[model samples]
Target: MADENAVIVNVLDLPIEWRHNITPYHEVRDPDLVQQLRASMEAHGWQGPPLVCDRDLYEVNQDQAYTGSHRIVAWALAQDDPSADMPCVFIQDIGEHYSIDLGELVEENFGNTYAAVEQFVALLPSDVAEAYGLDNG
Candidate 1:
């Protein structure tokens, strides 16, 4: 579970143009892992949303993948749909060394994290949503 201050949002929550604006934090070095991820997603849909950093906090700029960059790439390759409704859990603070409050931004743009997640989940494809047990949300 995330800390109390963080919000779990998704790509669908962002404006249409921003949905595909996210980028990997670094170059993917393991092609084999990406292939595996692609296979898994093709068979099972998304296991879970990727964790992302809300870069620039106050603006709808490019977010960076904190985890699951490989999965993001795999999804893109597998689906050929960069604009697909991909889920993401946004972190406010990485650790004591870094503290950026993205939750406030989420609240400013989309009420609150919980509401945003509910709204996004409802937009997911039934099969995909059901696989994550988020179909009822």
Candidate 2:
């Protein structure tokens, strides 16, 4: 659980260096979606803070995001001000009892929803697929 007293920080101040790859595979970027998000943010502003976890228990003093990566990216791409501040909810002092394994967490969070798999497969070269043994047909 996060501390009830979490403070808002500048988006540039976010500890992105400590970020973990919480997704099982790369997600294809959608320019249209990015544009939509940008327009939304420009018109309505930020809806909420991104959820950030304290990595101090994992021997790192930085915070990592277990969620809201896309929102963060959208903010970066959309915001005109480089030093723009955004609200962030920080999970304070999480220890082993509250720890989640990365792989399991990714699986639980994303659930293998490869909605763009066909699009991805279409872009792969045949020799590349065969090299990776992914040439099913």
Best by lDDT: 1
Instruction: Give candidate 2's whole-model lDDT.
Output: 0.40
For residue 92, give model 1's deviation from the true position in Å.
1.5
Tally clashing residue pairs in candidate 1.
0
Scored by TM-score, the top model is: 1
The lDDT of model 1 is 0.52
- lDDT tens digits, residue span 17-119, model 2: 2233222122425667667766777766655444343344345543444335455455555566433344443332111213423334335546432322223
The global C-alpha lDDT for each of the candidates, from Candidate 1 onward, is: 0.52, 0.40
Q: Report the lDDT of model 2 for residue 73.
A: 56
lDDT, residue 75, candidate 1:
72
Where model 2 places Cα greater than 4 Å from the true spot, the runs are 1-29, 55-62, 81-83, 93-137
